[model samples]
Target: MGHDLNLNAMNYFEAVARLGGVSKAAEELGVSASAVSQQIRQLEQQFGVRLFRREKRRLILTLDGERLFQTTTQAFRMMRDVRSAIVRQRENRHFIMRVSPSFGVRWLAPRLKGFLDANPGWDLRVDGAPDFSDFETEIVDLDLRYGAGDWSGLHQEAVVHDFVLPMCSPSYLAELKEQSGDPIGQLLKARLIDSVKTHFRWDFWLARHGAMGGRMVYPLRFDRSNMAIQVAADGAGVVLESATLAINELERGDLVPLSRAFAVIKVPTYWLVCPSRHTNRRIVRLFSEWMRKEGSAHDDKTADMLRSLGCTIQEEESTILNRDIDDARQ
Candidate 1:
């Protein structure tokens, strides 16, 4: 309604919208409840719109409120990031590491503390980006990417050569077992989760086992391995993904092997990739070393779990999908 944007009102509104109540927003903002409420009322009047629908003390955003809140939240986040970047620039010994979103969220994120505690007086930023990072342009110090080592001119090390297997929730497995006695037949009838960006796919696994019958087409397809694994954990369907990434879920008994046929296809699951010039950074080497150890620990645990599940493991020999080049297309 005014020529200039009302920053204070917007900030107050964002706090209430995010916190779900005016009193909580006031408490966090170190302001009185009435002051917060006044800001909200003024904001509503300026826009000439009802922002929130009060439902038993919970502030539910209306359509217009939801739209404004989205923009405000993004703006605040951008401000925070800019501030952090500026602060890091003033400080020395800061490094940026890029990782695949799926791997970073499910696997590396939980184990990040070990590397930090071992090495202090340094700043480390972990970016879980879907796209492969352009090291030169992005100013990335380290990279953990999922793919076969195919990036030319880059010094790379296999973080862990991972194992892919068909895993599903306990409830889904029981329901799945009722459909067919034959393991292969059951998979054929069920919806298989296909992670399109991943090197190890459902078709490859099926073909390796010689169960290449029926449509062999997946109904549930996701771009990230973590997404497929999560849906499978929630009893959606059987997901063919890295057991290493699904360690927490497996440890929690959220997901189990669909069959006793354990698999260890030496396909590259994740790699510690960086430019040749950046390889010698002590921080990078230490992080890489820590990651490899963690990966080995994951493998050992996975192997023991598979054995407990009464599985007969087999290592498959096949070509792999090139990481940087092939993944860029998807």
Candidate 2:
């Protein structure tokens, strides 16, 4: 065999060996099947041995291929560890958290200052888009999902349980008070902002309030819950949204509760989810604990605000690991 072999050819061969097929490896590497085959052929010619035996469509790894795969696997893992360690050393610690868009924007985004203040020099990548299947493949450290925390292969921690409540701009409320004797009646007349995908509207709250008589009107319907809340803030309408989402706006006097027409909603709880194992990443552990503790702190703050207002508020809480999943369909 001639000794002018290329590392690039070996990489293609390694991909084929690990994936068990030239075509699949080519697809993953964004190259043509023929190109991958050519690279494998070049590698085998250089090594003076066939790395794989073709049986029908299957590419069975030969003895040489197996030996190469074991070595390459270790090499790849070591390379990954070195990259991660370098990043950690530069930033103190690395944290990548995946969370839903609305949750991240409405809740997490506003409160991240504290986390940043506490964990100075920590590198964090917050993915607001909610596809988590690739989290494992991408080596993501943590994911936050809004559900019962039934992620099959993740270490799950429940952060907070949430409820939907009627919210509107204070200006809208003032207008109602000026025009109508009863704010609830005026709210029924005001434009109703709809979160189209979540199927949340004033009718849902009206049903809970025993005033399901009015035909709701909508000036705008938003596909995103955040957009609907934005419209409500602009005095476009009254929006029914998760209290946790609207908390910052409410505290800042941007949004106000219209009435006590909020029903207990099953959706929109904070769950700290990640791959079922790997408790060894100190960054992951620290972020998870911080999420749970901070979520609890927010709940307590809400309860305290309610108490100061001369209203007794009942606070419900649950951990992700212990949340009741039996009533999912109920």
Candidate 3:
């Protein structure tokens, strides 16, 4: 009995240990449970050790099994990355970027055409999902994510620090005015739409104005701000959303602020994130620059618009702290 290792058996052993069962590993591998079990048996026989113990009909890895699984997982990850990188180059997958769903639909989609048109022959693939990309196994170039800019070990820069305000269609505003004289009473009586995914909520903004425990009815709820904003613009309800995402609707007079005050959201600023190595890539660098410019322009236009609308802004105490900035005061 030579101490030679079987790669096929190693694969099956890795799957069983990682998934905690032979059936699951078999299903994922598109093989039968018997075959997976056979492989595990052969691996154990070759190594002359019990790799897993059956605890209450569930597989629990032994110390040796755990150590091997760790090595196998890392090896598999590296192989996948190498394969993906080669495939991307062969298929001309130039650059892949990911952004959050609402930001893609409400903010970036309209302005993406210019970047595509400017960069000829660059195959840029964009994915809009809530899940953050794990740069270890995927060949992602850059990420435009909405967060507190606190992702560790990655280089990130703030693209925009935006505020949230109550917005509704002009027609809805007229309806509210006709129904009541007190703005707070009118808002309480009207349908309040909630964007469930945002860090800022109707309650937080309402709390700022000392309007707590009102009979607020959220007849509608959405996971994306784009959907909520659109619903509000259709005169269905009033949505408290980021001013930057609702800029187009505001400019077109499709949506108007329900209040004279905007709550500055201190966290969840849009950030451009990437591994330090990827940050120096030409496409990543150029796109990051474009995003900053667009963000700055949006801020300028938003400031001008808010000034014209005769609105003031509010900021709550810091939910996330930065060492360099002054702490937010009430």
The superposed Cα distance between candidate 3 and the true structure at residue 286, in angstroms, equals 1.2
Q: What are the candidates' C-alpha RMSDs?
A: 14.9, 15.1, 15.9
In terms of lDDT, the poorest run of 10 residues in model 1 is 316-325
Better of 2 and 3 by lDDT: 3
> Quick one: ranking by TM-score, best first?
1, 3, 2
Q: Per-residue lDDT of 85-140 in model 3, one digit per residue for the tens?
A: 89878866387999999898888998888887877668878999998989998879
Q: Higher-TM-score candidate among 1 and 2?
A: 1
Q: The CA-based lDDT of model 2 is what?
A: 0.71
Measured against the true structure, the TM-scores of the candidates, in listed sequence, are 0.67, 0.59, 0.65
Question: Once superposed on the true structure, which residue ranges of model 2 sit more than 4 Å away at CA?
Answer: 1-93, 148-153, 178-184, 197-203, 214-217, 260-268, 307-330
In model 2, state the lDDT of residue 176: 77
Error of 1 at 109 (Å): 0.9
Q: Pick the winner on TM-score between candidates 2 and 3.
A: 3
Evaluate all candidate structures by whole-model CA lDDT and list the values in order. Answer: 0.81, 0.71, 0.80
